[model samples]
Target chain A: MAVITVRQAISDALREEMERDENVFILGEEVGVWGGTYAVTRGFYDQFGEKRVRDTPIAESAIIGAAIGAAMTGLRPVAELMTINFAFSAMDHIVNEAPKLRYMFGGQFKVPMVIRAVGGGGRQLGATHSQTPDAVFAHFPGLKVVAPGTPEDAKGLLKAAIRSDDPVLFIEHATLYQWRGEVPEGDYVVPIGKSKVQRPGDAVTVVSYSKGLQLTMQAADALAKEGINIEVVDLRSLRPLDMDPVIESFKKTNRAVIVEEGWRSYGVGAEVAARLYEEAFDYIDAPIKRVAQKEVPLPYNRTLEQMALPQVADIIKAVKEVL
Target chain B: MKKEEYLELYRQMVLIRRTEERAAELYQQGKIGGFLHLYIGQEAVSTGLVAARQPQDRMITAYRDHGVAINVGLTAKEVMSELLGKATGMSKGKGGSMHMASVEKNFWGGHAIVGAHLPIAAGLALGDQYRGGDGVTICMFGDGATNIGYFHEGLNLSKVWDLPVLWVCENNQYGMGTAVERASAVSEIRQKAEGYGIPNERIEGMDVLEVKKAAEKALAYIREGNGPYFLEIMTYRFRGHSMGDPERYRESEEVDCWQKEDPIGVLHRWIVENKKATEEELKQIIADVEQEVEEAVEFAENSPEPAPEELFADIYAEEV
Candidate 1:
């Protein structure tokens, strides 16, 4: 096992895919010379040359639109949106074209494309720069939304996303770029639409994903010492959400807690809670408690920004309430 | 152009016009449902562009794209069936009149949203370039689509990357009754290409020969590994934006003036005058097109409705 940062794992996935398929190319703003904003593709420009590692203008719509076009025809394009917040400019392309091209055309075409976008609110970059809008893309039926917490899932899910016939929206956390984990070397493909039981406990089930999964596990360690054990279910893929493990965990522990960095109203937690209620209503001991970011535009002030985000304390509190 | 080529182009234009006329009639008869945007007067643009296509080249256009679809070889039967929501439709009854795609013929799509396909066109070009292929993607849109930001972005990206693409702006006077002059800040659509450092020119789209000449020039430029080329073909949509549009935006004189330059009528006269074909031969061509459209309408009427189970299918490549 090789310990690598989430950024390196993602870059490895892209490198392996590009090396495997001649049609696979990367296009985005500063993806060439600057080697990506977070340096995820530090040496891609030199290794792949300008044609394969293309540098595009700051036109989010065109970046995604071009990828869909290329994908529809013959090539597999990996488009970087710079940030998920910038995706709003290209919403029409993502919502209308990428998802509908195959279905609307009688399944004659496939948009074999992947859009990598970064999201999170730890940075002091106000509301626009810091956002967790994975739910927005997940709402669309045709797209596969994957947000990985660990470096291993980042590498594995990305490789799977690149290989999938359908379009996949790969959402990464802005803060988790340097988060190191034991990533297995060689060909590793984590299947999409599957969740992992990060930790097993008997008292309560704590379901979370992306950065929230990291926070949930940290909170679970402290709760375990108190003899109030918590099971952690990391939902790797947000769209074709792996609810089987979540349901099994719910069956094991009647109490459930959902943690997400997105807003509370009609968010991911609401969907999971509703599903849990429908599937395991008879096994429930308490109502599902949800811990999500406060409903407001994230502030620029560091303290207020951190306050608006879902923290470890929030997860412990939600799990305690469920218990 | 060869005599056979001129005759074929003429036949295509007449067939498109006849097909659209029958489609309008079917829409009024309630046989075909949903938004119907007819390519009434601008048949020459699609005919000329498709005439200049190579086997590997791709073609995509805006909603007013029946003519282009037919020109690119989507049988009128499938297009009519798609418009009627029959199971035998081009898009398996999923896409209506607004989207008719013939996958075999390299007809990428007839996208509904204006200016959306420009970047897709660029990407198609990028794909060809990546594979070391000389094929180019011809993307068509209305004058109104020029005002869209994607148009600028797509053009710039294609130009910067030196992608193989030919951008055709069919400046059909109006976009849903708003004239290009009223809506566009830079009414001369070809001028927009200069900002992206792309070579651009304007052509009289009323003439098929002029359109064909322009298309050939642009295709050659792209085939030689040059960047994207822009062609603003000045044309007009003789009908309203869609079937329901009252067209209260223009005057009778304006419509009559454009109708006088009807592409099919103009091409028919040109073919006869240039000795490409005799008047009797042209009459036979018209009769053939009329019969073809009649048969297509019958085919669409006879085709069965899409099965209810089909509604859940085609939403994704794999089972959702």
Candidate 2:
């Protein structure tokens, strides 16, 4: 198996889907001839031509809205917002129209659409350009929010999202784009709403996703040297959250620490912690601890930005608190 | 326009006006529930556009869409039953007045959320063009919706893709309670199309003939592969925005003045001026429409609500 980065895996998934079905098309700012903001769609324009590979204007709302419209009327559209922070402009279409159409109209219509945006903070892009908005989307009932932490996971879950009949918000971490991992070079799909245990242990459980998953792994490795074996759970999907693995892991570990890059207030980690207490209260040996970014606007200064987001040390601290 | 065509437009507009008047009565009597946005004075816009559309063409509009449904061949009975939340309604009583839809009629929908349906309208046109079908979509919304971001996005994309769609604005002078001048930065609704470089025109919406003429030009432009067209129909709402509206925003004289330009009255004058028919024939048509509307109300009032067990049925295509 060839090693591939998360960026390549996503582009490969898109290319494979486009090759498999003529109905699949990609549209976004700087997506076609300009490659992409992250160059994830390099060489896609020449192969797909102008029809299937489109370069849209800097209108995030229009890009997603058009994709939703196209998806409803037969095409399977994969709309790319340059960054997750920019997706707020299109929140109405994604949250209100795309997700609710199937239920509001009594299942007479379905918006088979996927909105792909790069999220998570580490690039010193400041507050406006750097944010993890998955929890905000997760608050909605009809949407399916997927955050894949690895290249293989990205490839597999994206295929699943494109094939599904519901609207899927496929969020990728900007910092994880260059991280490499072995990916299967064939047809595969990782079902949505499933969480995977990356590292198994019995002392404590560290749950996270995207960049948070990487930090959790680092923290897990550091904690192991101290003889405190920790289990790391990468929450692949957030909306239809797969809490079974988390609860079972908690039952064995008896302690848990959830991590997220979004702000602490009403964040995904908070939700995960709440669910842990609700399901496995008796199994827990201690109170659940959370590691999230500070609840303040991210500063553009390097030192301040780094301090605002959760690091390996932060996860380590949270793990120690839970243990 | 020919006398026959003018009379047809008048007939459709009169039917909608009378039907909505009866609907107001139903709401007062507690037969219909939910927030109902009546398409009273704006009847000419729907009738005019539907008259110019091809049989295979599609149509979509905002919540003020009872007129479009009726013009697209849904009987007053079906519409009335839907409003009454009867099981025999278009959406099996699941969708209320603000969310009516019919796939078979090619009417697309009665979407809420201001200008949300514009993109869907573009998609319908895109699909028709891609499939080599000689059809187009007429997307309708209120004057207040022109200020929305989706309106510009949808219009620009329609122009960029050269999609076959007629974006019709039924400017009834108010967007809910906010007047056109209050909410918009630039209040000339027709000029809103300039940013997209699409052809646009402002028409007298009170007259059915004028609306039909403008719609005919717009429809021909789209049909000829010239891309999307926009029309701003200057009209007024004879009733409040909804059933519970206090209507303290506008003066009583304003409503009375617009009522005089009622689409039906305008049509009747034209019919009399052209000597198309005696006054008795027009009166008979009105009586027949009223009878049809009454039967529809009876059917809706007697119809059953959805079964209690079916609440969980249509949540998904199948069980999640």
Candidate 3:
């Protein structure tokens, strides 16, 4: 195992996939000559020729639509949206076209593509740029939505996403890119739609994913210092959500707290809470607690932005409330 | 073109005309559900274009796709079954009037979104280009699609990458209820290709032979690796945009005027004038189309509904 940033893990996964499959190529604005906006693909342009690392114009529809088309013809195109905010521009292709092509055409075509989008609220990018809209993409049935919190999960899940036949939206949190964690080397693939218990305990169950999982882990550590053993479950994939671990943990602990960076209403927290109530109602010890961003278009001011976004303290408070 | 080819083109246009006419009737009888965009006056555009392409070349089109589906060799029965939402439909009744496709036939799809498939067409061409093949993607859309951002974006990317795509705009006068002049900056849709630095031409779409000749030249240019070529075929739809269209936008006189240049009528005259086929042979072809459509409707009515389990199937290729 090697400790690396989430950025490096994702970058390595992409490089390895492209090397393994000649059909795999990258296309997006500034993906080629600009070496990627966040420097995730810094040396990829020079390593792979222009044909594989294509630079596209600032047209989200074309980038995603073309990617879907290429994927239909047996090419694995990893299209990068400068940010998840830009996904709304190509929302028709992402949600309407790519997902529906195979089923609508009665399995005549397959969109074997990956849309890599950066999301989350931080860096004071304002309301439009800063959004954790993973739930919106997760709402669709045909598209697979994966948001990995740790470096290991990022590397493994990304490789799996690229190899999957369906269209997978691999969302990377904008703020979690530099966060470092241990990642396994050599062809490691963590299957999509599986949840793992990152930190096991018996006191209370804390379920989160992506940036929220990072915050939950910190809260778990803080609670541990005070002798409160809280269990943390990382939801790797949002669409085919593996509620088995979550339900089992809830059955054991009898108390649960769901954490997410998006809004509380109709968000990931709401979905998990509803599922828990419906599946494991007998295990309930208290009303399920949810820690999420305050309902507001994330403000521009650094102080206000951090205030609106969910933090480590918020997760801890939610856990303690459930306990 | 050979005499047989001309006769074949005439047969295709008549088949499309008859199929669409039956579809309109079925829709009125409440048998066919959803929006039905008939390709009555614009049959020559797709017929000619499909006739000019090789087996390897790909084709994609907008919501007005039943004609393109038949032009690419889909049986009238299959097209009607799809329209009737039967299990034997091209898409197994999953995609209704606007989503018929055959990968083996190289017909990409019957995409419903206005300008959405333009970029997908570019991607199909990009795939061929990446593999270093001579397959050109022929994308068909309406005049209204040219006004959308996807049109410009798809066109610009095709030129920048020098992908093999022939963008064919079947400039039927109205987009839904709005006229081309009211909705678009330039009424001449092919001129928009100039902004992307792609060579383009405007052709008379009412004449199938003319459309076939122009499409051949445009496709040849792309096949030769010169890059994407734009062909804007001037045409009109004799029927309303779709079933239940009030059509308050255009006058009856205008519809009648364009009706005089009906694509099928133009082809019938051209075949006789050029001595491609006798008048008796042409009339026999029309009678044959009538029989084909009658049988198609009977086949569609007899076809079964998809099984209850089909609803949950094919949503994802890989099971969760």
How do the residues B1-320 of candidate 3 rate in per-residue lDDT, one tens digit apiece?
A: 68888889888989998998899999999999988999999998999899999999999999899988999999999999999999999899999999999998999998999999999999999999999999999999999899888999899999999999999999887888999999988888878998889999888999988988899898898899999999999999988898889889989999999989988888788888888899999999999999999999999999999989999989999988
Worst 10 residues of 2 chain B by lDDT: B311-320
Per-model chain B TM-scores are: 0.98, 0.96, 0.98
Candidate 2: residue B203 lDDT (0-100): 84
CAPRI accuracy category, model 3: high
lDDT digits (tens) for residues B1-320 of candidate 2: 56666667767887898889999999999988988889888887788788888887888899988999898888888889889888878776777898777777788788888987887788778767766677888899998889988898889888988889899888888888999999988788888898789889888988877777788778877898989988888988888899999999999998998899888888898888889877988888888899999999999889899788657665444234
**Quick one: best lDDT, which candidate?**
3
Compared with the true structure, what per-residue lDDT tens digits does model 1 show for residues A178-252? 889999979989999999999999999999999998899899999988898899999999888879999999998
Q: What is the interface root-mean-square deviation of candidate 3?
A: 0.7
In Å, residue B65's CA in model 1 sits off its true spot by: 1.0
Weakest lDDT window of 10 consecutive positions for candidate 3 chain A? A314-323
User: What docking grade applies to model 2?
Assistant: medium
Worst 10 residues of 1 chain A by lDDT: A314-323
What is the lDDT, from 0 to 100, of the residue A6 in candidate 2? 93
Docking class of 1: medium
| Candidates in descending lDDT order | 3, 1, 2
Report clash pairs, candidate 2.
none
TM-score of each: 0.98, 0.93, 0.99
Clashing pairs in 3: none
